[model samples]
Target: MLNFPLWKKLMVGVVLVWSVLAALPNVLTPAQMENMPSFMPSKTINLGLDLQGGAHLVLQVDMETALKQSYEKMEDDVRAALRDRSSGTRINYRGLRSNTETGIHFTVLNPADVPTVKEKLHSALTGVFVLNEGTNIAVAYTPEELTKMRKHALEQTLEILRMRVDEFGVSEPLIQRQGDDRVIIELPGVTDVSRAKDIIGRTAQLTFHLVDESARAGHRLPAGTGVFYELIKDEAGTVLDKVPYFLVKRPALTGENLNNASSAFDQYGNPVVSITFDSRGTRKFGDMTKENVGRRMAIVLDGNVYSAPVLREPILGGKAQISGNFTVTEANDLSTVLRAGALPAPISIIEERTVGPSLGADSIEAGRIAVVYGFIAVLILMAIFYGGFGMAANVALLFNVALILSVMTFLGATLTLPGIAGIVLTIGMAVDANVLIFERIREETQRGLSPMLAIDTGFRSAFLTILDANITTLIAAVVMFGMGSGPIKGFALTLSVGILASMFTAILVTRWQILAWLMRARPKTLKA
Candidate 1:
């Protein structure tokens, strides 16, 4: 075990050097890291929300809205499917209506049309179960279908939130589904709570609807139409006034048809969002523009009209631009939301808390003080207990610390208060390995074995014991990481990394130091 091969020596040297360099960024300021060369590693361990202090939001997904929207869409499909004249027999229905909780209800005018409509309803909705109540037929989602849809909605909502947060450039944001209909978001170092909430909460549903010029303001919208108030903002984003536009309930093209959206400048150097549509959207948009060549089309986002450009000619390219009175940031954010796609349903923040940087600074300082004092204490004790062997262990312990930081930085792991506690625990465990080895060596020395022989036998004997203990601890860390969340996960991560590093340093690195010492001094007696 004491015989270090050339490759092992080289590996140890390389790892030590690399770890120190990789861990350097963590100790440096943001300005210092930026000043570093591009090729050099400037990435540091990302601090968790607990350590950095940022936005904490608990959002509840509007599942009712999702279910209602689904029912409404199913209603439209049922109408389309039952209205087909190709079946030779006309299927008549009246009093067609959909309720949020009760689903879709429609009565067949003729009892003979019931069987035909039921078939069409089944064909129209994939997961719906249809029930016949004499002349009245009710369509609702099956239990299994509802469960699946709710799960999908939650998953899709999480993904959309992640994309939006990623576009916002949050350093280490945590976006995950909580319960069946809740989402938890943590934005580290995000001080602007209002902006973060605005960006995350906005549905950003963009649709192109034709402007109804005949409809007068203040008059209630007629059936088959809806009113969307367009905001008029001054230089600031605050709404000065709102002008209502009555339009057809159906949109000509929605953002769902968009393939991509990017922020760009218009011909006049004003910021705009350029969008590309998918094939189906291309056909629909092309036909719409061709048919409505002299009409104005309103570009609406979340029921607010950004622009209502007059359709001059057919847009066959599937590409269009949205120009409006927008700042660069606004344009970029809009493009981000468009590209990310709309959330499955609206999300309302049920719980919100803002963590201040002062608390983060205090936490960081406390963590720093604990680590420094604990490390120093460990170093002092290790050097004093086993003398020369203790000094060797101290060297390995230092490398272990550096290796932990390097691994965390490379993996982009978040560091929290519990993570620091894990490191301190690792410091003790690392020394424990050395203590076992040194005690074994002392026993070998008492047996009158030569210093080099005693060292080799001690390490070989201690190897299996060290491996067994560390491996078991490593397994625990793995389980912790897999099962835990947030701070517990952070703790597990650092603990796991520290265990591996400690094993390497204790078994390989410290042995190399002792072997080199033995070879150079040719000691006749062991010192422990």
Candidate 2:
């Protein structure tokens, strides 16, 4: 009744065989797969964290500090932009320099030099901080006017975190910004989770400060501040080099200015990081290089200097390349950091989870035991009761398993401990459609029909019942999927796919096989 073309049959068989062969590598030991060619398809099921020995962490990024840093940067920008226009007038911030209700009210001095001071104020504040020329000019900012400026620092910090994640090279990584100021990172298979934590945990924020030219020649750093530099040591542990505390000299150089950064070979064919900056950044950078031609400008992050080089001349053209004593990996990582920009906030690992390989093995064993026994009992009962039809049902059951694996592999889905239980449940349900079909066939034969006709009748009548039962089960599985988190989702996914595959194999494939048998024998009486 449902004969397939010879070519179609060959194609189907080939697909099934190739899929199994392709997947075989995944099922084999890692060492075996490694020995095989890279083009070979992997067959092994990807284990979830519960099965794989790995780490899980829930981190909280500090947004408040990020906000303060952003505000401070704006404050500094305003000061310097104004100071650069100095006719050198003395001014003091009056009480309540800013009240920031409907607008920002910054009270300042220089009553006599109103026009010149207003010109300087106009350069930095612009439309946001308008002046009211009185005994002391009061500048006020409009509501929500500085929102974009406020978010700059935090946004930069978040960008840096994304770059760091890329550097770690974890597959199928999940890094996302959580509520307001937090970030969530889920690495499925990680060996050294603590190392990752250490790298990301560092704020890596860099700042530049001029020598405080107003202070005395022999002046020491103020109480709150101290000079910092990289304390590099040789084998004897002697201080071999020092890079300074500043990330960049004087004016701020935000990571946002960077357009492209990549690792490539220099003229000597050594690894180097090439960088390109935006128009505005190129000008600022050129000015900085032009001034500090002989001094070492520190390339610092999280208080440690990565490099400090003396400028030979102004690095113009908005383009430059950094060549350092680094391997290819190091150069690439630095380039990635430059590419990701910066984070919006400082992030710290607050909670961590590490599942040992031993524990994972135990979990797998326990799951396997539960699934094996659960299906074995049901399979045994089916064979004892239904004879030939029962064997057909077992075939369908195997098909269900194959299809489930195929679907999972196609999706690149992870298998968890609960997911194994779902498979076992599927094995039991695989027989349900067969049982219904065979029982209906028995009833049709009792109604005075020949064996072939009765078998046909059984399938037609029982199809609806099989569909209804599977659909109901599917609904339940969907509900479970909704309720579950990571592991639960795995189980629900497997169960749902198994149910669909079971319907096709049990109702259609087995029905067609039985029809072929009935056509050949042309029996007068039904076997059941």
lDDT: which candidate is best? 1
Residue 131 accuracy (lDDT) in model 1: 95
Q: How much lDDT does candidate 1 score?
A: 0.89
Candidate 1's TM-score reads 0.89
Question: Where does model 1 exceed 4 Å of error?
Answer: 28-40, 211-222, 232-241, 260-279, 293-296, 305-328, 446-453
Candidate 1: RMSD over Cα atoms?
Answer: 3.2
User: TM-scores of the models, in the given order?
Assistant: 0.89, 0.72
Query: Per-residue alpha-carbon lDDT of model 1 for 1-528, expressed as tens digits?
Result: 666889989999999999999999989898888888898888889898878899889999999989988887887798899888777988888999998777899899999988988887787679888999999999999889999999999999998999999988898788877879999999999988898898899888888999777777677666667787778888887898987777776788888889999989988898999999999999989999999999889888877887888899999999999877889988888888888899888989999988898899899999999999999999898877888888999999999999999999999888998999999899999888888889999999999999988998999999999999999999999999988877788899999999999999998889998888889999877754
Clashing pairs in 1: none
| Segments in model 2 whose C-alpha atoms lie over 4 Å from true places | 1-23, 28-43, 76-105, 108-163, 176-182, 206-250, 259-283, 294-296, 304-312, 316-339, 368-375, 446-449, 475-484
